[model samples]
Target: MNGKQDLSKVSVLLVEDEAFMRRLIQRMLEDLGVGEIVLAQDGGEAVQYILNNSYAFTLILLDLEMPRVNGFEVLKYLRSAPDVGNHDLPVVILTGHAEKERVVQAVQYGIHGYLVKPVSKADLISKINRAMTKPPIDASHLK
Candidate 1:
């Protein structure tokens, strides 16, 4: 992709537990010109997928609350796992909780962006564009 408008080269791992929400986000991503999307129902599944295919995704759209492992845990794992080779991967938190504490915590975890529930396409695209422009997080900074 040459510019923010062209996400044709972008590939994402969408980790969401809700089936309906997952489909909705997937459609939005497709509309944004994303080339590939890998789905994970929960954080544990996301972890497994990331481990198996570390370099496959250009970004991750992670849900904060899930049945197994939650987004926070997944973030920690990604930061700590040397073998995964994804410590710098962009992760945008997608959550219903917009509480100050939760948002602060996510920021501390080095999330690229945070999107509240009922996300609009415009907001999503803007956030994605902003995140994509930033330099990848250095794993050493987390420690």
Candidate 2:
């Protein structure tokens, strides 16, 4: 448990429709000592949740392809507002993809970072820590 724990210190918003995938990511974040976890069944819910509770989340792990409101749409929604107070929230796309062009496109869209699906708890923890603590490409640079 080196450099780990204090679950009451971190909060996460998990946006995934797949119940199993959501649970898995939740468990992984929890194991990393996230204090609170917000579960959004779809992109619509995720957006609303962020609007209503943006201040609570230290990070958001989003999935690219989802029903109703895909991750791209959600990101667009967030960017369009610019008032959610989460414009800088660490959002890491967790998906089962590794296409270079797709990744670049995502980066162009202002994603804080990304991790392939089935991401290990350890990797999640590491990425989570880095995303929240590091200086992501300045918000001003996002197109």
- The C-alpha RMSD in Å for every predicted model, in order, reads 3.9, 3.4
In candidate 1, list every pair of residues with a backbone clash: none
Expressed as tens digits, the lDDT of each residue in 94-126 for candidate 1 is: 999988778777777788888998878888887
lDDT of each: 0.84, 0.79
Q: Per-residue alpha-carbon lDDT of model 2 for 70-120, expressed as tens digits?
A: 988888777668757667677888788878766676776677778898888
In angstroms, the error of model 1 at 28 is 0.4
Residue 136 local lDDT, model 1: 42
Please list the residue runs of candidate 1 whose C-alpha ends up more than 4 Å from where it truly belongs after superposition. 1-4, 135-143
Instruction: Give the range where candidate 1 is weakest over 10 consecutive residues by summed lDDT.
Output: 134-143
Worst 10 residues of 2 by lDDT: 134-143
Instruction: Give the poorly placed runs of model 2, Cα more than 4 Å off.
Output: 1-7, 137-143
TM-score of 1: 0.88
